[model samples]
Target: MPDGPNTLLDLNQRSREVFRQLVETYLATGDPVGSRTLSKAGSRTGGVTLSPASIRNVMADLEELGLLSSPHTSAGRMPTEAGLRLFVDALLQVGDLTDDERAGIESQLSGSNRTADGPLAQVSQTLSGLSHCAGLVVAPKRQARLKQLEFVPVSPGQTLAVIVFEDGSVENRIIDTPRDMPASSLTMASNYLNARLKGRNFDEAQRRVQQEIDARRAELDELTTRVVEAGLAVWSGTDAVSGSAGRSLIVRGRANLLEDVQAQEDLERVRRLFNDLETKEELLQLLTLAEEAEGVRIFIGSETKLFSLSGSSVIVSPYTNAENQIVGVLGVVGPTRLNYARVIPIVDYTARLVTQLVR
Candidate 1:
């Protein structure tokens, strides 16, 4: 046994080769790889002649170093979370997506008559089908610059605030109005905001409006000022109907998590995972971390708090806008035994396709 930094660099060439082969086999079959299996699978180890006894000695050393684990009295061994992390970080060789896959992804996302919902829905489904795992995407928040603002009377003390964006998107919010406020006050506030806030984002418009009010440049009665403030606040706050800072979270293929359940413990873990997905807050926070990542980010078992109990892994990559600003994140969630060599590139390509389509 060779030891130094406890990484792949620390292992002797033969030991590294054996460990790599064992992890690959376990990932493929989701079963432990015994020393005898390694001996028989000589081709996987570069035709190295390793007897079962010799393989067993290496497996024991790996287990002692916390890289492998044994279940019950089985002679085989499976990679631990740490082992999977090490392999993903160093030993794995990523594969490219096939031409058919690239075409499929491009066709789905790059339709001529595409609506926001259509591309996003198809992307999630495509990812789920290709990866055989649950697909997850943190949809970009639809924030548009102010094009027009209108206040219409709804009832005695309620006014409807209709916001039209530069992109032609429209949203309506009901705001409480002072009963004594005159109908002309609505027009006054609407005209005032439209002149100053056009083509400005929500934050920028709000700041400019407040600055004007503080400087006392615009002459207005207290009632009209309150009406203008209320109108701006509605759009500034999150769209309550959609939730999550106006961003949508898409999760598909959750049933895939249960397809391979072989025990009560496995079923319980799947149930927990389903519950975790339902709580979108945690998943949103997890995906937000990918915004700062340059490319793909892998979170193995126990590394992410939300999946610690479920022992799941997540692979995420951020998709950017034309300006290279990250607008959203897309990824896959599955068991630790997922084929990272294949799935990693699939995610990478999907993210790039999404970015292009978004632009």
Candidate 2:
């Protein structure tokens, strides 16, 4: 504990016990803790044999090390963000979830044949209930494989581009048509796409079609080129091998912010957290690091730039398809002082659930 912000550590048994007691009491009551109160909590276990005076000295040392902060003119101390991070990562010992907790999560994630939104919404609600904090879930963009492309004339100057995916997913886009174009033009483009690019993804179709159009420009009319270009532009914006979907987000449990226990000291940070959730692109970028992770990954405050503004923490793990190709991610976002021991396993289990669903 020499200088500027370092993670909390207590090597000796006595110091460690004192530190643990402080964090446990603070978490339980959400209050600034005095040394005498911690001494009583320690005495119940007969683990820490320090007197109040001695505990105060230890707390002073911890505060000096940037582990605990003392309120002005108050004989009480609380853990800083760094201290809470260290407690969650190394010190806290979370027991197995109770049967009810297991059931709550399982009931939502298992044996359900609903849309992707169903399980995700359930996850957000459950997390909020369990943690008494706001919950968040970013929806995974749906990417359906291509089956057929059909163009139908919707109006004199508008045509409907209907793309049917192999998975029975359908997407439609409207494109402007050149005046005096024949109905046969629609038939020609649709037949051409089905003959050449059926069973391929939109990107593959785009590349092959572009090559064909370029090589056979002399053989094609203006209407065909416009139809192909419109189709390509529409598919390019999807969450496939083209541009980004910019990510989807879900947040639950905002009412947990009204928990009456924690003092109304830094409520603004929590407010900022909610506001940040509204702009999910930033959160998705923050969690995207998990796509490259082997297992669950934790990003504490200041660890990544995406979450720097609010000093929040994220626990993320990627979900994969049957082929082991990563498809999406599942995670939680909360204050830096979150119960990592509990939430870490929750996120891990949810990631597995997502994988099972996609597979």
Candidate 3:
């Protein structure tokens, strides 16, 4: 037996090769790899010629170091979450997207209609289909400089608030109004806002418009004042219909997660995963934390408190606007044994592409 290798750097060539081969096998099959299986597989990985007895000794050492675990009485070992982190940080061989995948992502993002739903939904769909994992996205409301704001009565108590942005995007929001509200009052409210929010961005318009309405309330009739508040309310995230901070949470491809559960023997862990996805606020908060880093971030199993019960992993990246501010986050969630080497680059490439659309 060799001296204990505390860190990856401490591992000699033979130990490193054996460790890599074992981890790769575990990731591929999501099963423990016995010493005999590894001995037979060694030739394929790097011509490792150790006997089964020699391989067993190495696995025992790895187990003692907390890098591998034995789930059964069988003489097999599987990499633990800490081992996976080490592999991802040092040995994972990230691959580039295929031509077909690149084409697929481009088609999805470019073909999406910029409706109230925005393009983020399309992104999640594309990622889910391509990655075969549950795709998650944290989308702040679409932003653009104010071009114009108009109000048209749709019915007795509902009006259409048509907003045009400098980026050539149009958004239509429905506002509830007094049952007998007149069209002239809606027009007066729209004109007043257009005068003040001509070149302001969404957030700025939200603040200034509300302040103006409150300051000049005496000059306007009660009906007109109500319209003004409702108009700015749409931007300030006060609309109950939205019920979010002008931000949307989308999780696509949950069916993909179910497929993983079917492949693995553990049903209880995956059931917990479904419950975690339903907790969108906590999941969104987890994704937001990934923005602190520059590139793709991996939160494996217990590393993310929100999904710790699920024994799941998240591969996420943040998308930024022209000012390089992180405006959205996109990623996938799956079992801890996900094909990290393949999925990491997919996330990295998708995030870059989304950044262009955001700009």
Q: Which candidate is the best by TM-score?
A: 1
Which residue runs does candidate 2 get wrong by more than 4 Å? 1-10, 111-113, 150-161, 173-197, 203-247, 260-265
| Residue 300, candidate 2: C-alpha displacement in angstroms | 2.7
lDDT of 1 by residue, 214-313 (tens): 8998777787888888887766644343445546789989988888898888898889888888888778888889987689999997899999998899
Question: How do the candidates rank by TM-score, highest first?
Answer: 1, 2, 3
TM-score for all models, in order of appearance: 0.83, 0.77, 0.77
Error of 2 at 144 (Å): 2.4
Top model by lDDT, which number?
A: 1
Ten-residue segment with the worst summed lDDT in candidate 3?
1-10
In candidate 1, residue 208 scores what lDDT? Answer: 88
Task: Judging by TM-score, tell me the better candidate of 2 and 3.
Answer: 2
| Model 2 Cα lDDT, one tens digit per residue, 1-359 | 44424333344667778888888778766678998897787688875678999999988888887788887888999887667777876787856677786777788767544764777777667667776666666565555568788999888888898988887877787877886768888887787778766777666777788887788853457887777677666666443333345346667887775564254445766767667776666666666678776887888777877666776787777888889888666667776667777877777776777777768
lDDT of each: 0.84, 0.72, 0.83
lDDT of each residue in 64-150, candidate 3, tens digit only: 777788887967899888888878888788888889878878888899877755578888888888888889888876566889999
